[model samples]
Target chain A: EAGVTQFPSHSVIEKGQTVTLRCDPISGHDNLYWYRRVMGKEIKFLLHFVKESKQDESGMPNNRFLAERTGGTYSTLKVQPAELEDSGVYFCASSQDGRVYGYTFGSGTRLTVV
Target chain B: LAKTTQPISMDSYEGQEVNITCSHNNIATNDYITWYQQFPSQGPRFIIQGYKTKVTNEVASLFIPADRKSSTLSLPRVSLSDTAVYYCLVGGLGTGGFKTIFGAGTRLFVKA
Candidate 1:
């Protein structure tokens, strides 16, 4: 089976612009997660979607960032008026079940805000 | 969530066994230990996870003591391709209760 896949391996945007990153999880996976890492920082969780419903979103940095999994299949993370701090690697991961199995991560989208 | 501490970096030979240890002194009763490997520009890939005792898979081995306060990830006869950043994360597997946090991770370098 194919692993989780992310779109636009690299993206460069100007500050104050908007950007959207996409992720397609493995087949039959119900747990999808979004994470990102800023420069010189560790990867941090953004949110999680269990099918079409969001299970957790406490890690979302601010109101400018939004994530949605409409069909519970693919997910999109949108950042409005992106700031310099928003530049980082955005990673999407999926797990068959919340427990007893490890998550599979995508290659990640490297966002650069200039 | 329990905080994990691991060596910042390690070096090993191409055909030598590499053991990376992570310490989680205040691990919760139901927390599981997980290890992930990340290449330069890729997201983390799960290597192994164990609650207690030893768990071995085709890729690597995860050893957790009885206390579950620490765990070791052992890669046998590592090759140059094994060089990557390894992260140890601890968390409960509940549906909506816990979140997985990634640390700086240990950077492994395999030399020929």
Candidate 2:
């Protein structure tokens, strides 16, 4: 089976600009998640999606960031007026169920905001 | 979600067994201990997970003591390819979903 696919493996944008990272999870997976890791920091949860509905978005950093899973197939994370601190690797993951099973993560998108 | 603490780094030789331990003193009753391995420029891959006692898979083994305060990930005959950052996560499914908490993790470097 094909693993999770992320678009624009690497992106560099100017500060105050907008950028969107896309993730196409494995087929038939019901749970999708977004995470980010800034330089020298551990990976941190951003949000989670169970189908088209958001399950948890408590980890979102601020109002400038938005995530969407319109058809419950693929997801996108958008950062508006990006800041230098937004530069990091963003990862997308999926799981068969939100239970005890392991999650599969994508290669991640390295975002660099100059 | 509980927090996990592990070594910053470790070194081992090829064909040797490597064990990385993680401590979660505040682990809850329903929480499960999971480990993930991540190579540079790549996302993390699942290695093994266990609630208590021991669990072994093709890639690695997870040993969780009865007290559940800590766990160890054991890799047998580690090769240079096994060199990566290993993360220990402690959490369970919440009403919304599983919000996994990742620690700094243990960086294992296997040499020839």
Candidate 3:
């Protein structure tokens, strides 16, 4: 049980730059999710993927944000033209099937958009 | 989707039983109550979950009243490592979508 793993535990980029966060879920897990926590705010869901197809992405902030799960294995969240508000922690989670309970979350990627 | 309310912070001593209650009066019938623990610079981990009555695990216990208006997460004989933020989430996996919303969370500081 490796749990969920996230790449680039921390990332720093200039405003208007592009930064992509990656997540590798546990083996044989078909359900993957993305969540973000802004400064002084609660963690919010960004999107979810069941295998390679996106099951739900209604939580995405705006057009600049994009999430993809290639080959139904790993997920990537890309933020283009990042803004100052984009500085926050992005968390990835996974569960069996589409169950809401018993989800395992990644340590999260701290993105600092300067 | 049911919104949850919990304390902003709590303080307890080692070897003492800690109880943190969450209010979710509008919780739906199909929704479940789940609690998570998070350390500094770490992701949230599942502790316990219950829909009604009581549920116990090696790590913690979840108590839900008959009305299901609220739920309590009890940590027994906590240690310094238990000092972290605890989150209470209430959501149902409806076809509409998943509504797992995290609140401010209660920061439990365990002292020796």
* Candidate 1 residue lDDT tens string, B26-89: 9999888999999998889888988899999999999998988899999999999999999999
Give every collision pair in model 2. Answer: none
Instruction: Give me the runs in candidate 3 sitting further than 4 Å from their true place.
Output: B93-96
Q: lDDT tens string, model 2, A1-114?
A: 999999889999999999999999999988899999999898999999999999999999999999999999999999998999999999999988875345899999999999
Q: Write the per-residue lDDT of candidate 2 for residues B45-110, one digit (tens) a residue.
A: 988888899999999999998999999999999999999999999888544587899899999999
Error of 2 at B84 (Å): 0.3
Candidate 2 reaches a DockQ of 0.65
Tens digit of per-residue lDDT, candidate 1, span A3-110 = 999998999999999999999999999999999999999899998889988899999999999999998899999999999999999999998887625599999999
**Superposition TM-score, candidate 2 onto the true structure:** 0.97
Interface RMSD of each: 1.8, 2.1, 2.0
Residue B58 error, candidate 2, Å: 0.9
lDDT of 3 by residue, A63-90 (tens): 9999999899999999999999999999
Q: For residue A100, give model 2's deviation from the true position in Å.
A: 5.3
Interface RMSD of 3: 2.0
